[model samples]
Target: MSDPVQLATARELAAAGSVRDTLLVGQRGGYAVRFKIGAGERTLVTKSGSPRLFTGIDAAARVLGGLGIARYRVDSSGLAEEDLPRRRRPDRAVALKRTHENAAYLEFLQQRAEAGRRDTVRYTDEQVNERMRTLRTGRRA
Candidate 1:
């Protein structure tokens, strides 16, 4: 989204290898790019014929191509959703596992909640306004 970030990413891709080796570029409804860096995966998407997106992509591709890192390509057939790696979904087992891991913290939170209810403070409207004024103006209301 940010120019610097996009450029940095392009540079990384360029450094990795040839564009043809690193990127799976396609064009269908729009432009789609799929690539992986380490274990992290990313996809860059731009609407077909979008001036801004095209300009940015072109610049990036030119820089990368000039550096001999990658080649950009456009294909009529786009990447299939099923071909992309699926994100891991946390199920009930995961929730239970996390709850078990945080058991002590959960108990502490429960205790704190009980204590908070027992120690509740009921302030007069003027007292509340005074506190708010102090917070706002950094002086006694």
Candidate 2:
């Protein structure tokens, strides 16, 4: 059915002010509704001037549909995943391109590191050995 007519029907079914509240009130995950009953999750839906406990949103929807209060019924057990369009996997060409890009970046970093080490100041053999020992042990030689 059309959106506007369907929304109006849903609002009347839930006794809510707006369409958003109607959907919120009809929390269909477990098919349960949160209408004002007492003070908790349990809510009362009046039928024929008598207050009745609505067991599930599906049942409420059925009653509303039977009474022409709702334009359509929602399937509680339907998988939302089925409604989504299938996603295409990236081909081998794209995967290989990404790997090549990563390898090139690593080679650039390696070259920069080697250049940094080569540009470092040179010291005497004995001083170099002492510096290496200090660096390896993280302490004075």
Candidate 3:
């Protein structure tokens, strides 16, 4: 097989009708586009020389459509639908729960502080300590 073609070159070839037939092949990560140019098949690759991958069939179709190539064959026999990677964020869920809990606790503490500020009564440190001792002992200080 000949070397893979970059997206720009592929687009030009597709627009010029040099790409006789297009095939969408399902790969490990995503769908790859293979073009039948002359008698050889060429895979679409990125500028970095890696096989270009599309997240889904629709995406690949849209790209091919933009290149003026419509009507392509899909070979999904290699695709393992269940094996596709899924987005998961268990850490994010735990972090969000902790964030909400912290916010609620902060609000509760703020309300208590505000109530204390609104009260006319005040006590010195020694008086407060004595009051705490009396409360602990269940006796007058």
Candidate 4:
């Protein structure tokens, strides 16, 4: 099993504030622990971690003792067939749970995805060198 995410104490995350949202990315592999403060209402998407990421974070915390920020824990003991039970959080079983809990975060992710998509353009091999040249050396390939 992959590593789990390092969970922080309520106090550790209280500073992020009720309105402020943040991503609890695992230091080693960037797996997300939870949606945290803001994870709802995304208009678009750029990059997203796999659904299994939560499971990995749980695995990670079990392997490593919170890595330095503070004390941490991820509950991994469930008798269900799936180590992680989705029914437990039926309301949030959807890949993206649109709610007050994750509003700001979803907006951030959508914006980044939209912006990145617009900024990047695909080109074929014949146009590759030309595009690279235009991007790097003015307007000539």
Candidate No. with top TM-score: 3
Candidate 1 residue lDDT tens string, 63-114:
4465465544454255454444434667977998898879978999999999
lDDT of 2: 0.47
Candidate 3, 31-74: lDDT as tens digits: 89999999899999988899988878888999999899878999
TM-score against truth, every candidate: 0.29, 0.23, 0.60, 0.19
C-alpha lDDT of all candidate models, in order: 0.52, 0.47, 0.89, 0.42
- Each prediction's RMSD over C-alphas, in Å, is 19.0, 16.5, 6.7, 23.6
lDDT of 3 at 125: 100
**Model 4 lDDT per residue over 22-122, tens place:** 33343232343433435441111113423224435544454233323233433334322344334366656564555654898888999999998898676
Residue 138, model 3: Cα distance from true site in angstroms: 24
lDDT of 4: 0.42
Q: Model 4: runs farther than 4 Å from truth?
A: 1-32, 38-46, 52-68, 79-141
Worst 10 residues of 2 by lDDT: 19-28
Error of 4 at 134 (Å): 85
Sorted on TM-score, best first, the list reads 3, 1, 2, 4
Instruction: Please tell me which predicted candidate would have the highest lDDT against the true structure.
Output: 3
> Is candidate 1 or 4 superior in lDDT?
1
